[model samples]
Target: MKKVFQLILIIFSILNSAQQSEIFKLKNYRISVLNDSIQETSGLNFFSEKLYTFNDSGNPAELYEIDKKTGKILKILKVKAENKDWEALTNDGENFYIGDFGNNAGIRQDLKIFKIPFKNNQLQNDSLKIISFYYPEQQDFTPKNISTDFDLESMIYLNGKLHIFTKEWASKSTTHYTLDPDNFEKQAAQKIETFKTGFMISDAYYFEKKLFVVGYTKKTEVFLMIFNESNSGIFFKNNPWKLYLGSALSIGQIEGIAVDETGIYISGEKFYSPIGNTKPYFYFIPKEKLKF
Candidate 1:
């Protein structure tokens, strides 16, 4: 019996180590500190071959086109919708989806996503659409502050649907849900899959059958997870390649990620804590630099 128990402990140790292995550090990949106008940069996406980002809650409802090389704001486009804690940004080929569902307290009833039309290198704000949704599993309306698992921040567009990943602060996991882009009426998100990410997922980007998610732990440790799509087009069915990016103390609060044929782009909002403060920054990782 003693020998059997010892073997079980050894196996558990090995599994735990594999789950949290530190693969890469992103400190060396930072490109430049972003401008002050978008200090609270929350989400990133590409439209018409241009990189775009916007500030989060309490900021203006505008999107900024940024230079991929220098992190400078090239132009700003106004939106007709409300910012309302916008935390995730994604796009189909013709439209941009902005998720305004950052439910930190987990008591918000107005979770919504704004679908804005983009054409001819301009935003057709007159045709903006709002997608309101709720989690059917959420029974309690009590405010749990930062201890709720229903808060969401990461999202992507795939297979003609909007895929949302919850931040899951209390559970240290993320739940995947899908919403219809054309459904403007109040609807319930369809739960798909959940993964034990061990961190709060802030943003996700999908490219070439691979999904990249970025977030930070409460201890200020930031990480990146890469998962390959399964045969049935599901993520999180297999173990992801989890890489430790860096501490938030040094990297700021990483809140956005976008990928293109060239490589990956990440953005961090200005972060302030009792220990230190980090300015908003932008990072670029070339495709060749990644080993897997």
Candidate 2:
């Protein structure tokens, strides 16, 4: 009986070690600290050969164009809208979509996305479109507050529709939902699929037929997922390359991800954890360095 118990202990330790070994330490090159005005940077997007970002709740409703090399604020474009938890940014070549659906409490009924038109590399204020949507599966409006699966933060524009990924704090998974961009009325989001990602998906980006998601766990464990597209909206059909990219203790609270032809860009807000305090900063991972 003693020998059998020892053998079981050895097996358990080996499995734990294997899982720990999967955690990869990323060589994060800190470009610079974000501007003082845009401290709570929530989402990032590359458009018109420039990087654009915005602050989350409690900040002014403005879009900031950042210098890619220095992380400095080059331009600030004010949008005529409310910043009720702006979480994700994506552009459809001509129009930029701002997701105002960062429902950490899971009880918000006013989930919306703002569509602003841009022409000649400038933002036009006359054609502001508001898209209201709701999840068809959410039956309860009760506030779960960081413990609900209805909270969403990541989004991408694909095939003339907007794809949203939920930040499920309770279930540690993400649900994919599609919304038509042409529809302005309150619409029902079509649930497509769910991926069990064990991390709260904070931002999403689609590049070269691949979908990338960046997020972190409550314990500060950070992760990045890359999915090869099998269809337009079908992302979970193939298993994603789940890379455990160190911990938020060293990387801060990762909230945004953007991929360009060169490599991946990541940003994190100021985070306070039991391990240590982390300042808001931007990081770049070169293309050649992000090997599976």
Q: Quick one: best TM-score, which candidate?
A: 1
lDDT (Cα, tens digit) per residue for candidate 2, span 1-292: 7756754564465345338535556535778777778778998999877999999999999999988888789988999999989999998999999999999889899999999998876788789999999998899989899999999999999999999999999999999999999899999999999999878999999998999999977766778899999987789999888887766666778899999888888888888754357788888887888752
Against the reference, the lDDT scores of all candidates come to 0.88, 0.87
Runs in model 1 lying further than 4 Å from the true structure: 1-19
Worst 10 residues of 1 by lDDT: 10-19
TM-score of each: 0.92, 0.91
Kindly list the per-residue Cα lDDT of model 1 for residues 173-263, writing each as its tens digit. 9999999999999999999999999889999988889999999877666788999999544898899988877777788899999888888
